[model samples]
Target: MAPDLPVRAHARRNREKLIATARAAFATADGTVSLEGIARQAGVGIGTLYRHFPTREALVEAVYGAELDDVTSSASALLDELPPAVALRAWMDRYAAFVSTKRGMLDTLRAGWASGRIATPTTRERITGAIATILTAGAREGSLRADVPPGDVTAMLVGVLLSAGTDGTSEQTGRLLDLVLDALMVRRGPGT
Candidate 1:
């Protein structure tokens, strides 16, 4: 059992290292990046990478899935640390970063989707669910308007991001996110 445990731990570490390395490579790569290069950067042999991810598409899918999971799951974590309105704003930043990262892998992702090699993810639903979670909490706390639908917020955010484009400056994106947050926030009258 002890010997098996070490091997499993080592394999887990290798797998995580490969994924992280691949994610960085994909995020910065101008075109198709070599899988061998990813393994070299991760300090693992090419065979190890193949053992963990049988194909390039598999690795891309895994990286995409990992990013999606992080962005979606961050909603609850942020809400725990900050006010709902603040958390929602922070989540928008995370989602924007996630979108930016996809730029490097867009070609491969599009090809995979067209070829049906990669399973289509329920991306919109998951994103909407995360927004709903934050909005529900904010509404309960009277910080956000309860009348606004989460799907509308998602649509508006997508529009803001699409309009900004991948080259959008942080200041511009920040201003847009602020506008969205302001729209969702409950306003108070002067002098209570």
Candidate 2:
């Protein structure tokens, strides 16, 4: 959104800064950082942060939305530069990163939802769309299975990430992802 004037420009800039700093804190903190702290770290007053985000969930939505931007933007890049299967794999890797961040902010995110603070779609749908885009490309190239729905793949990945987050086991995530990928790959039934 292009601002027609300088005051709107400053508001845009302030909101961007708030989102950026809140994201860093969400990713790095022990999921305990509050809105006041986020505002302070962003070098803005609490009032300004509240004026912009209005609530914790609003700030969280901003952060989660930025992550959607990252995943979808990377998908475009991978599609432009790499083969379908390779691009899909790289996007899966980004999924892991996204899951990691999501887990870190789990508590705050949940709290926001519980309080009805953020009104936008959660990261789930956006992430699913991003995965579906890659999977559709892979299917067109005869790499991934065409029958499975993208929403199913998205649900599977989210379930895997959640389980991996709970178990705190790195090996499980890779193994589970391989199983998911198996379903998407060209079928080779029963020992080739």
Candidate 3:
């Protein structure tokens, strides 16, 4: 049954708090933090945690979904506020940060994906669509190469993340992302 107004408002706050705590825990822990600890860290009761997320997998999936939602949604918003190439670069930087945060959650995420608690296709499509939107804008504005496919760019990003693994340094990731960004930019005439 649906909760009453006050109860629903309280639940929403608790859920948001839980997600915030989980994000920090997953970003720093070594993939072994407990759900009870997460609840305590969020300052919520165990029952409240279970009310929002019945299982560890559920909580992990929610965190991942929330991250993906933010990154994907920012693509268009960034484009509106900046040039296409700049927006794409900004989005890529955000994506790299998300990937770094994801490293700590790798184990739980892998298990969740294997158990079908996490839906990979939807996530993949959403990310790819976001890249496509940015690339489409870049092409229209003559800032990025029109010949390169968005899927190719998405694949490249996935490759970068996989290669970075759990221990890649920020400098290393920045250089790698710069390479990808360089590849996507339109070729300029020499000294023109």
**Candidate 1: 10-residue stretch with minimal lDDT:** 100-109
Clashing pairs in 3: none
Task: Report the number of clashing residue pairs per model.
Answer: 0, 0, 0
- Model 1, residue pairs in steric clash: none
What is model 1's C-alpha RMSD?
1.5
Q: How many backbone clashes does candidate 2 have?
A: 0
Clashes of 3: 0
Checking candidate 2 for backbone clashes, the offending pairs are none
For model 1, how does the per-residue alpha-carbon lDDT over 48-99 read when each residue is reduced to its tens digit? 9999999898899999999999999999999999999999999999999998
Query: lDDT values of the candidates?
Result: 0.94, 0.80, 0.88
Query: Whose lDDT is higher: candidate 2's or candidate 3's?
Result: 3
State the displacement of the C-alpha of residue 58, model 1, in Å, after optimal TM-score superposition: 0.3
Task: Give model 1's clash tally.
Answer: 0
Compared with the true structure, what per-residue lDDT tens digits does model 2 show for residues 1-192?
455688888889999999889888877876577888888888889999999987676777888888878887798789999977778777877888777877667776777777767654646677777777888888888888888888898888878887878565767787888888877888758986
**Cα-based RMSD of candidate 3:** 2.1
Tens-digit lDDT track for model 3 on 110-184? 988888887663877888899999999999999999899888998999898778765777777778888999999
Q: Write down the RMSD of all candidates, one decimal each.
A: 1.5, 3.5, 2.1
